[model samples]
Target: MPETYRVAIMGATGAVGTELLDLLAERNFPVEELVLLASPRSVGRELTFKGQSIKVQDINQIDFSDIDLVLASAGGSVSKEWAPKAAAAGAIVVDNSSAFRMDPTVPLIVPEVNPEAVLEHKGIIANPNCTTILMGVALWPLHQYQPIERVVVSTYQSASGAGARAMEEVKQQAQAILRDEKPVTEAFPYPLAFNLFPHNSPLDDRGYCQEEMKMVNETRKIFGVSDLRLSATCVRVPVLRAHSEAINIEFQQPLAVAKALELLHAAPGIKVVEDWDANYFPMPMEASGQDDVLVGRVRTDLSHKCGLELWLSGDQIRKGAALNAVQIAELLVKKQLLKSKTVA
Candidate 1:
């Protein structure tokens, strides 16, 4: 048997952090010791792990010397501050924030498509944005058959991608609207209940939201195609869990819907749910709480040669953040990277 790992979960109280805790237990990740870390405000808080209650530790006070892996999901700033420190202390850090993804030195990873990149990491591995992760998962198989020339995507993301405060905003706004009261906005610039906002984050100079740019850049990095043409429009919807995207791709070689479906169905970590005759397709409600990226609504784009379109959906906090990080940690263990007590 492989050596058990000592794992630390930073941001133990947030939505994605909490989901990581559950995933660790569910996957039986060969964890010998689990350290839960959070900000000073969450110190002394109790969180249950493997039937035992564990107290959350303020990140500043924890010793990382013995930790085999650190899964961080606190936020970009927290990750930027602590990830390198933890790595310097000898733990492999799998980060769920956008802090290090574009750092060139840090490998932006999606295990199914780029597991080899994890080996080239300088101590930290960055998880791609939730939207980008699912998009790449659905496209990689096709890309392998025929290189994609260009990609156009529009995301219908969930409130959970913004964090717990945004989820509460959706719930509160929904209740107020039902009670004949005007809903107030706090987590979003506009009321999220019964509404759709075309913006997912602050817009960059190119007029694409930050979230959209993440999809553009991360996709190129994970695919190792720096010149890959990609454009995205990310939007926030009232959905509470899973995020969905409409994707159009132009490939170098022709790919039929049937062949694409076959490839997606055989791909690991993906589920093909295209059955239009049964009125079945990928939806946020069904994709919620599931680990697989659901793909459906496949059709040929009539506008261009070798063009195809599809819909992708998955739990933002799961495949998007916590679950993917945990899976990378698992890969580290399987490859014996986490077993060695070496830091680089």
Candidate 2:
């Protein structure tokens, strides 16, 4: 584009939205203007960006025509109504929502896994779900060496996946429980303080919840493997940030643990964080605030000769959502793929 692009962050007050602000400043994205869009309730509230106080604007009242890049972390319903409008108004939208992820027209992207997919975006680019992004970054390196035959994953997701309020709710719930008071439940159906549960998303006829199915479908799209066999079990844990996953991959041929660890160590957007002597691998606490997906526990699976097992922890809000979106924007900038005036 231009010397610098005018960018906007939709749902700018939410957890992911705020992270977007921080990442853009930290990464030094080519920003001429940074607009923050939120709900009417959050209007007039100010958020810091490069030490500048930018007021949150009502999404309904903002004009998108001159905005070149829109980083959308608003909920699905909000993005559903606004993202297209932003794209149609000539801004390329990187949407962090489930609304258009499975849409054949929209390319589901994880910059590390499918940076080429950024070029295929018609107008709006879909950011893969947090759990999907975490697993994809960790698995794609190995999959590149040999095509993965199947994938089995279970997620220990944190409250940050829900949003800012949900994260605070967990803290409040823990406090209320210490006082022997009933924890308030609003952000989630149950108190996520002292307990965990199967993902609260709606379940389908096959019994997989929405969060689980998202991993299954989005990973296939990102990997360009429509028939990729994958299964997921997502759980909400008491952790406030970062997400962890235990993944099992069946490859076409036997892959050694040393080879797997070597691949991960050299892979982009990933860090091999194994400390066997201390019995520590990637933990959510350590993964928090880090840009890289921390991966460790590489070993061969006993059930199958060609199977490999691994574990990963990543900042769900940073690398999982906002960072992935920011990387897509950077890819666009590098490839000269973004347009000043997107024609819908």
Candidate 3:
């Protein structure tokens, strides 16, 4: 018989948190007990799971001692403070925040790219940034076919990346603009309804935003290539759900278009969606609510013989956050990697 474990979701009221709840039930995780936790303000809010209303609890009030697994997605600051506490209380935390991603003692993971890393965790495992997870799953297979030299990527991120509040704010902004009214700026500094901008994450002395650097650094970590030459330009688009990326990769050797498509199609967590005749390729609308990353537009970069260009779209809230976390939890249970200390 399979072991049914107690599970707790930190930040259960947020966008990704809610999605995590859905995926856990949909995938039929063997959850003997489930607890939904969030900030104090969110306490008492009821969330449904397997047709049962689970009331949200104060994150500060929970006793992690009874929980075997914790899926945390509150935010970096929240995770920085609470994750260690949860782990100290004997829960294995799979965190969906950037707080511990770069920590030498912590393992940053995308199950498709580095499932083994999950076994190295002391008590907490870090889920890579959403963009990193989406790209890593799509590119890792190709990188394995041949070593990659350099990667240049541009992202079209949607409102969902900012959470459900921002998603609603975009719709409100669009309606206000249609009524010839001033669009309010709350979730974002600029209007995202019909406009786009460079990623708004704080910039550093090098002029690169935090979001851009996450792609650059997290990719190298997960790929185990410390000096993997990579550059990213992240833009926030008006799309409501999924994220799209245009990637140009230079490999050690030129990979033929057919071969690259074949590799991507065969890769787990990927769906090849190309139609040259209609000029149709992976699109965000089609990728939303999906479990797989939709990839297409495979072609050779004419300028460099070793370069290949492709496009991809994935649900930011689903694969980027919820599904990936759930996958990690599943991997942990399957491999008996839960409770890293016990595994050690």
Candidate 4:
């Protein structure tokens, strides 16, 4: 008999939450039952899955005891409040927030880079930040070939990372600008249309914003390297979805461009798209809605013999958040790591 699991999406009506629902159906996960959960204002909203309409339920009312897997994409606050309850109620959580990511106890996962780490999870797996996940997936293969000593990255992030409403706000801002009207500043601290700014997350004493630090700290945790030298600058671009990054890496051993291309081409979850003749490379438009991270512009850094530069773009809402969480759930099932007490 085929084994099936009961699954619940903690923020089913939100951006990442909606993507999670689509991925579960698109991947044909062995779901015997599906439940949609959201905040009180979103309750009773209808979302379709596998040809059936499932009404969004308030998370407070759902019984986690029967759910084998919880794909949580709600904000950090909600996850902090509910994730422990879900885990204690016998549900394995794959959380898509910053809430438990830096928690040393939870294994921060990017399945392609660190599948073995999943085996150590007690009841939860934390997905890396979108930028970190994309960079990890694209760079880990090369790192395996030659250890990376340091990384410097700059991100061109889309409004979708802020949420679906933020994306919509960008559109409205653009529309209002066309009429020469003042752009609204509700979704973001400043107008995002026809303008860009440094990531607005809170800053640390060292001046790194929370988003930038997430890449630094989360990368070290996922790669299991406590001292991996990395720094990042995150910027919010006007694009509605997907994100692009320019990465410079210093390897412990000398690596050639051809060798780097060979490693990236053979890596999982990465697509190489370089057209030197036309100077074409990965773009946010091309990467939007794609599962694989698009990587290109591989070249040797001019300043250092052991350093290399590359560009990559990926769907932030997909592989970065929802799809990664779904993949972790699949990994748990494939490895039989879901606690026996939770598996029916």
What is the alpha-carbon lDDT of model 3 when measured against the actual structure? Answer: 0.92
lDDT tens readout by residue for model 3, 144-258: 9989999999999999999999999999999999999999989999999999999999999999899999999999999999999999999999999999999999999989998
TM-score between model 4 and native:
0.98
TM-score of each: 0.97, 0.97, 0.98, 0.98
| Model 3 RMSD vs true structure | 1.9
What lDDT does each candidate get? 0.91, 0.93, 0.92, 0.93
Candidate 3 wrong stretches, greater than 4 Å = 339-344
Clashes of each: 0, 0, 0, 0
- Residue 175, candidate 2: alpha-carbon lDDT: 100
Candidate 4 residue spans exceeding 4 A from truth: 339-343
Query: In angstroms, how far off is 17's CA in candidate 1?
Result: 0.2
**Model 1 per-residue lDDT tens digits across residues 19-137:** 99999999999888889998888899999988999999888778888788999999999999999999998889999999999999998999999999988888899989999999999
Between 1 and 2, whose lDDT is larger? 2
Whole-structure CA lDDT of model 1: 0.91
Clashing residue pairs, candidate 2? none
Which of candidates 1 and 4 reaches a greater TM-score? 4
- For residues 1-344, write the lDDT of model 2, one tens digit per residue: 34578899998999999899999999999898899999888999999999999999988777899799999988899999999999888889999999999999998899888888887888899999999999999999899998999999989999999999999999999999999999999999999999999999999999999999999999999999999999999999999999999999999999999999889989999999998999999999999999999999999999999999999999999999999999999998888876554333
Better of 2 and 3 by TM-score: 3
